[model samples]
Each structure stands twice: as structure tokens, then as C-alpha cells.
Target: MQINPPGTVQEQRPDALTKYLQHRLAQRDREGNLRRLPQPTTGIDFWSNDYLGLAAGAAATGEGTALPCGATGSRLLSGNSQQALDLESFLAAHHNQEAALLFNSGYDANLGLLSVLPNRHTVVLYDEYCHASMLDGIRLSPVKQAFRFRHNSAEDLEQKLRRYAQPGTPVLIALESVYSMEGSIAPLAAITGLAARYGAAVVVDEAHATGIFGAGGTGLVQQLGLEQQVTARVHTFGKALGCHGAAITGSRLLIDYLVNFARSFIYTTALPAQAIDAIARAYRYIGEQPALVVQLHDLVSYFRQQLQERGLRGWCDSITPIQSLLTGGNAATRSLAGRLRSQGISVSAVLSPTVPLGRERLRICLHAFNTRGEIDLLLNLLSSCPNPDL
Candidate 1:
């Protein structure tokens, strides 16, 4: 191993510094962990979250499409547009919410909601395995009082509520409808029922479930008929919708409160007209073609069945499109991902600090456009891998 002395610059005469960086780089390379930006190429794509394959379709294609590539400004200031209002109206009606306020991304939506909605007197109980964005939002929150229960354990949530429930303090329960990394579904109905019992408001992040779960792909809340039960629901168009931007759906009063008090929503410029138009078009497409969702469910079932048949069911625990294989060490996980990529699969290695230190693994995303043959080929490759831990 090499050590780099302090204050050593690349042009300076420091053999130790050069050796130190070189050694670290070599370690990563040896473990198949050295990451590089891929030279863009057309290939069998299994890595993207475009589950319906709409992003690459003719709908999203246009000449000079890249002109308005950047958002330019935040939503509150120069970013406001008619398209944003139109999308909000469409989303509000689609999800049966009073109002919908759009944000830059799912992360921003969560941050705006969690950090601002919970005041000093509020208590936030979040799922242990919730996405980093939600955690980050909670951290930014003015409310210092927060705790996490076991992931998707309604009993654990009830226990926490019993301990933390107060008369005047607002108890906000944050959980995702579908865990992005594990692909496990959350017990939305049970959780909502518990919240009702305890008088706590519920916030459900439907990033993964949007455009794939409910009728017309509204989300898990709509699927379970608990839209009115939950206090707030966050939906992102980036994944299954094949568009960018996220929205927080709740009462018109809540929307008004966020507009006036949520700093992230107030200070930022809105999304452009084109982006909003794209989301509207995506929703229209979703409404017209209900078969896409059915196809996606079928594909997910087919892929899971293939895994079970190959005796690799133990490697994953997901029924949704996001399947993960837990290969404990970062080194092993990266190696397996590299091997899969070389075989022309686009699976990615989820490494630490994204997950716990020893839980790093390969994240495989399934899409409606992916054929049964591709699923079989990928599973066969997985079965043949020298490291089956992944």
C-alpha cells in the first residue's frame, strides 16, 4: 500500500502521493470496483427505470428536442408555466387529490414535504429502508424529534406510535409504497389504518409504484382506495412515467400551505412548459393504453418465476420490477456486476453507504419492453456466475 503526504499536488515532486492514489485505484480495479462513465452505446438495456420503454419512444422524440435541456431556473421564480398548472390539474384528478404541486424531482418533493410540513412540534416516523431523499428531508426538518421502525412492519410502527403519540404534536408517518432497492411492497392499508387509529398523518412516497400499480397507474394509494386516508402522497414521473418532475398530492389547503411555507417549493423556479407537457402526454398515453400496466405485471411475474425455476429465488425478495441480489462485500458485488455487464446486461452494483456496509448487491430492474427470452438469458447468466451470493 502507498501513502500520500499532505499538500502534495499532481505537478509537485511527491512520489508518496502518486503511489497512494495509485494503490487505491489498483485496489478498486482488482475488486472490479473501479467505476468509469460508460462510452454511450446502443445495447441491450436492463439498467434504466424506463419500465414502459416510453422514454425512448416516438412520443419523446423531436427535432431540436435538446434545446431546452436545462430547467434554467427554479419553480417559484422564472420556472412557472401553463404546462405546470395543466399537469397539476391532471395529476389532482388522476389521483383524486384536492391539489398537486410539482417539484424538480422526487428528492426535491420529499425534501420540501418532510422538511417543511413537520414543524417543531411534529414527530416523524419513517421506514428504516426508505430512500435517502426522505431521510435527508427528515434531517433537514426543523423538527428534531424523529425515529425509524422496521421496514414495512405495521406492528413495529404501531409500537412506535404508542410510545411517541402526543395530543397536539403532529405525527407524520413516512414510507414508500414500493421499496426501490428491494422491490417489496409496503403495507399501505394496514399502515394507513394504524395512522387513523393513532390520529397520525401519513405520507406515502409512490415513486416506484407510479405508472405501474393502480388503475391508470395512479399509484398504490389509489390501488388500495386509501387516497383520503393518507395525508400526502409523492409521485415522480421519471421512472415508470418516462418523464421528469415529481408532485406532492394532498388537500388544497396542504398545497396552499406548501406554497406559502415550504421553502423548497417557494424559492425554486418551476419546471418548463415542455417538461410539463411531456408529463401530460405521458399520463394521456397511460390512460389510453391500460394494457401497458398489465404487460408490466406479467413481465414481473415471468421474471420472478424464471428466478424460482433456476433455484435463485433466495438471491432476491422482490415482486416488483426492482430485483436485488445481496452480495455482501462491495468487492464481490462489483465483480458480479462487471461480469454481467460484460455479458451485455446493464445491471448495477448498489454499494455502501447507499445500503448498509455488508449488504451491497446487484440491482436488476425489469421493464415491460424486456422480452421473456431476455429474462431467461439473464437468469441463466446469474445461475452460471462463479459467485452465487449475488
Candidate 2:
């Protein structure tokens, strides 16, 4: 037997950049975490973020579909349309904020907000489990330091605040209303109360809570009655509202501050008027069809009750529509998701790097349109999920 080391078949061909990317891709494939665009399907819709069943709504239209496909330039340039302004104003009043500034996406809104509001003299405190966008923003900001508090632990957050407390230095505490991955709601009341006592500013991202929780889907922040205490609330229309774009709601002065200093907001092209109309349609739908929200809550309750009936209530920690079931490994999680898909169901497995190792799980997003029978079927499948490793 000829004993030769690896790489005996071919000489290296890719350049440095391509080789680097190839290595990364190879590693991801080995880990079963290589992501690809998903194919369209008619499977049961349990994998999407369309919590309010609004993404399937009609596309924006008026007299015709002849509206321009894009706004063509940044908002500071020629792209700020009257339609966009009207939506922003409506968002401001509806959310009980002094003003609102629209961003092209939730990512841009978080990046812009964090980049502008903090300086070298500021201490940034954030939940360890906050979204990647928020953490990325904090990483890219000019703030000299940032501290992490344990997820949903107000006591740990207060400890961070105390550790960073100093004279003349502003403290910024950021968190999500509902964490996207684990589907757990934050202790907003406790966290905000801690911020108030420490004289820290609070910035909340309400991406997952929009159009599902508060009065007419105002959001969890408004529902908790801490609207005035929080410094800024970033609400996105893409998740529950099933539209595109995000809004930064706060005082008029804060809006002015971001408009002048936030590079992400200043440098990007504005969203199209048609997209703004879609957002308006979603808001109007929520306002007129209050029964949808009620139905969603009921569905969530029913799902939880079913979980309890199956002796699985302690498996997950979420009360809202977003729920997850832990599977312990990447291959196992994907195997479970594949089993569901093979049976005409659509569900996604959260793999490693997105979540910690050995904590891979299935993220199940519930909608108002999911029937009781569908829920029962899904639970039955989950109950009987086999050992893929076998």
C-alpha cells in the first residue's frame, strides 16, 4: 500500500480569496450548517415569520401596478417620497412617540441607532442573546466599551449597569422585545425599571412583537406601559405585518440626531412608495381587523395547551406564537426537520453558530391561520420523531 498524505490527487488552483471561501464552505458543510436558498413549496406553513398571516396579503396596488419599482436614491437625495413620510407620521402617532424615522430594514435601523447614539464616553450594555444585528451595530459603533448581561436576567443587567456606572458618562442598555431564536420574551418591565434607577437609556427592538401583542398590535413596549420611559423603540413591518421596512420611534430630537449622524440611514436608498403603501395596508388591516390578533393569541394558547396535554409544556419557554423544541445536535435537528418536510410540513432547524452547539432546535412559528388539526398533526409528528443517528 502506498502511504501518501492528503492532497495527492490535484495541485492547488484557487486563488487566495477563493481558497479561503472554499475552506469556510467546506467546514460549514462538515458541520451541516451550510445554508442555501430554500425552494418554493405548498407545504404547511409552520416555518415562516408571518405571525399575523399577513405576508400572504395582496401586493400593493392602486389604479394599476405602474408605480415605480424603486425610489432610486437615498432619502437625503431624491428618494424621500410623500407616501413614505405619511407612513412615518402615522407610525409616530400610532406608537405614541413624538416622531419616527423609517429605515430600509430592521438591520439598518439597529445599526444606525447604535452607531449614532453612543460615543467614546458612553457605556453600552446589551443582552447576550440580542439579535445579531444589534450586536453587530454595537461592535461597529464608536463606543469605547460594551458589556453583556445574561439573557432575560434583569439582575445581571443591573449588575452590568452598576459596574459601568460613572459620572458624566451615559449608559445605553439595548435588548429585544422578543428574542428571535429562543422565542422568549424579555423582562422588559424589570430591565426598564433597572435602567431608570441607574439613569441609563433604553433602546428596544420590537421586530418580533409588532402587530401581535399590544392594543391593535402596538408592540410589547407599549403594552407594558413603559412607552414614555424607553428612549427608543425600533419596530419593523416585515415580520408580523408582512411588509418591508422598519421605523425608529422616539422623541423628535432623537429622530433629528439620527438623521444627521447615522451613516447607514444617510447613505442608503430610500424604500419605494409602493412598499410604503403595503405597510400602510398592513397597519390598516390590523386596525380594522382586531379579531386577527385575538385569534392569534387564542391559537398560541391552544398550542401551549396541546403541548401540555402531550406532556411537553416544559420543553419550551415561550408563550407567544414563536416556539422552539430542542434537539441537541445539528444533524439530529435537520433530520427532524427533514422528517416534517417529507410529510408535507414546513419547519426549519436552528443549527450551530446561529445557536450554541448541542442546543440545535426547531423554530416553529405559529400563525392565526393554522388550524387546530394542523397543530395536532405537527405535535403528533414531533412526539414520534425518531432517532436519526440510529
lDDT for model 1, on a 0 to 1 scale? 0.77
Q: Output the worst ten-in-a-row residue range by lDDT, candidate 2.
A: 1-10
Every model's Cα RMSD, please? 18.7, 18.3
Task: Provide the overall lDDT of each model, using Cα atoms, as 2-decimal numbers.
Answer: 0.77, 0.79
Residues 1-390 of candidate 1: C-alpha lDDT, one tens digit per residue: 122221122121122222333444567578885533123234575654445544433244443443243333444433445556767877887888778899988998998888877766778999999999999889998787899999899999999999998765678899999999888999988999998787788889999999988877888788777776777899999999998989998776567666655677776656655677788889889989998888888998898777777767446577899988888889988888898899999998999998989778889898889999998888888888787562
TM-score of 2: 0.82
How big is the positional error of residue 184 in model 1, measured in Å on the Cα after superposition? 0.7
Leading candidate by lDDT: 2
List runs of model 2 lying over 4 Å from the truth. 1-66, 387-390
The TM-score values for the models, in the order shown, are 0.81, 0.82
CA shift of 2, model 1, Å: 64
Question: Which stretches in model 1 have alpha-carbon errors above 4 Å?
Answer: 1-75, 388-390
What would the per-residue lDDT of candidate 2 be over residues 1-390, giving only the tens digit for each residue?
Answer: 111221122222222222333554567678886443122235575654444443444244423344545665677655666777778788888887778899989999999998767776778999988888898889888788899889899988877877886755678899999989888999988988887787777899999999997877889988887776688899998999998999999876577667766788888877876788888999999989999989888989999898877776425688888888888888888888999999999998899989988778888999999999999999888888765421
lDDT of 1 at 128: 98
